[model samples]
Target: MVAERTSRYNFTPGPVPFVVSGGEGVFLHTTDGRKVLDGAGGAIVANIGYGRPEIAEAAKQALTGMGYVAPLWPTENRLRLIERILDRWVPAAAGEAGLTRCFLVSGGSESVDTAMRVARQYQVAKGRTERWRVAGRATSYHGATIATLSVANHDRRRQPFGPMLADHPKIDPISTEAAIKDLEAANPETLAAVILEPIVGSSGAALISESDYWSTVRQFCTDHDILLIADEVMTAYGRTGTRMGFEHFGPAPDVLVGGKGLGGGYAAIGAVLAKEFVAEALAEVGDSIMFFTFSGLEVSVAIADRVLQILEDEDLVNRAAKMGAVLRARLEEEFADHPHVGDIRGLGLMQGLELVKDREAGTTFGGALTPAIIGEAFKRDCWIYPAGSARVPDGMMFGPAFIISESEIDQLVSITRESIDAAVAGLQS
Candidate 1:
């Protein structure tokens, strides 16, 4: 029955996984009575954990008070969420002339698409209508939308949409000199923006470029008048300990994209924020952004505002930083010597565990290792997010809720180790 129902709605063809009945705190309850720890926070969402009664109350009030409103208009919840992000969350954390404007959308893809459009629009508003290209790193995942897919270079995801995607110039992900050369070759006058992730998530398994690289890129973007956009969908709002992932390094991007954590898995909401000058240029032209009808749903904004308030009142951001240290220590202590585990790297709670055929030989088993390992982990009552691209072959992301306890961390690590071993044994046999 569970298999039939799951297969009916989901697009994926599969032997159905167990039905998730409910979730509380850091654990998910199965319909069959199996309780599993949430290791990946439901695709790296769930900052405040699960089953919070406060979220329910907030949702009820929002729907009962004033239901639906158009995107352009401002209601109490919309105003509150905008004020919260502008005044408390992003203002200071964003670079010198901080972000002064934001647009709310449904999810990561929409948020990314909005940023891409704004970049193009910014150029058009400034009379640089010829600049339409948005450069991005060779291996990155902004979102699933067509425009975002065109800007990013995740091979597998873009395979089917090759002909439809715009051929934006690409740059090296790590090398500063190569990246600079690539930028110059892209022809500054024709490029409008450059999109990047603070730490490469799915495409590179939380890859962190040196601080110098980010600083250099910032200067290069500034020199060329190309806006730098940071896609923080998977690393913002307490996931990276800091408010924004870029805070770990130097200056902030001209445009910042965020989602998932904003609503803490309670609502589907995303935001694309821009520096003051970018918005002013568009406003000066008396131009505006096109809004998606469900841009800022009354219920969603209410839930998101309530969620951010909870994150603040409970000090979960600081807790994420503190607990992230403990999670890192546990991962290091456990997987440092494991052969299948090649590397462990990340900031705050968003850590990536790399997989290899053999760590000593620096060999990889391509992308096959990830699914095998993930399958094993699921059997052990843990679900971790599989992370990789065609370029970055195999790995998994471990992003639990900020409220996760030390003992829960222990179980997660232990289960992961055992799952890796089991998968390896199965492969050998």
Candidate 2:
């Protein structure tokens, strides 16, 4: 028998414990033949779950019709998807999630890249060209590309590329009051826009902002003439039980960047939804026409169209809402007695469990705690994302597929409880 080389792939696979081969519902099959329940949906990207026949068929049909087309030219699928998206969000929000126009891109990084360009262009169009700095929230993730990386708060993700990042202002995520103070101190005149994940995803799944906080920030941006961008790449498309995360807020964002579940992980796609005013600014004074070759191709667009239809037909968004409540309730019931499980918070399918060392004192777990818990969980064939700082406590963020059932939801909560028990027991022993 001919022997193949045993050299393995060395790329980092985020916070996952193993390589996933396939998934059905919320269960993922790893290459090592382990079927682990996907509690976090692979960074909250797979909302629809794995192995969908309809989505597969849509992609196949597009391939048969026409494989690829550039955005410089027009295509039928692109036009249809754009019309469909505008029709859905525009009427629903009464112009609150004001994205009357859609600009497609390859993925989330490209979407954020376009967002930065659009922000700077908006400033230039309004004749505030000197407003060059981009302000981003600490611990929020935009993307991995250079400009987006510059604005991104994932320390580990950005450390290697630190030298090349463009100069931008950063605000700590302590409070909206503190953010305002920092922004003012960092030359508010030069600031073009402030971007944030309506719900923080990466850093401990921190859902610290209150209901009025977003509205206050929106008003502040308006008074200061800085564009507000809602980076819904992780929280959009029913992840938060709404069409958009900003729907939970008071004022609409000037730009809404969505990608992760935009195509439901069936295709690589992202889009920037801009207000009519932002579109007009681009039309009037912006010289650069943003275009990516595979941004709005036939296959990706067809998949997107079907994904939206499925979301509506199946009423999965509502499912996310119902399941989220059950999951949260179960967590509270199961882990209420546990000393390590500090706090649990989320919206819809997006939920997080902060594991601390002591409940009475609220002391956080150190760096060693995460790997121990994650390893123990993997042995049980359960995959959950572990995040947070050593200085602070650790937490697990979970946003399972919207189509998840009550049994599966219970399983998730049970597995987490088991993982926690095993970890704690090991430490105590």
Against the reference, the lDDT scores of all candidates come to 0.89, 0.79
Candidate 1 lDDT over 135-188, as tens digits, reads: 999989998888989989888788999999998999888788888899999998
Off by over 4 Å in 1: 91-96
The ten-residue window of minimal lDDT in model 1 covers 91-100
Tens-place lDDT digits, model 2, residues 1-429: 001122244354334456668888788887878888888787788888888899988888888857667675667778878887888744366365556878888789899889888999989988998997889877667888889989867776677887899878888665778888878887879999999888877664645575666877788788998989889898888888888887877668888889988898888899888888888887787455478767786788889888888888899888888888888888889877777877788888888877888889876656556667777777788877776642234777888889888898888888888888888778778
Q: Evaluated with lDDT, which candidate comes out highest?
A: 1
Candidate 2 similarity to native, TM-score: 0.92
lDDT of 2: 0.79
Superposition TM-score, candidate 1 onto the true structure: 0.97
TM-score for every candidate vs. truth?
0.97, 0.92
Candidate 2 ranges beyond 4 A from true positions: 1-7, 12-19, 30-33, 94-97, 389-393, 425-429
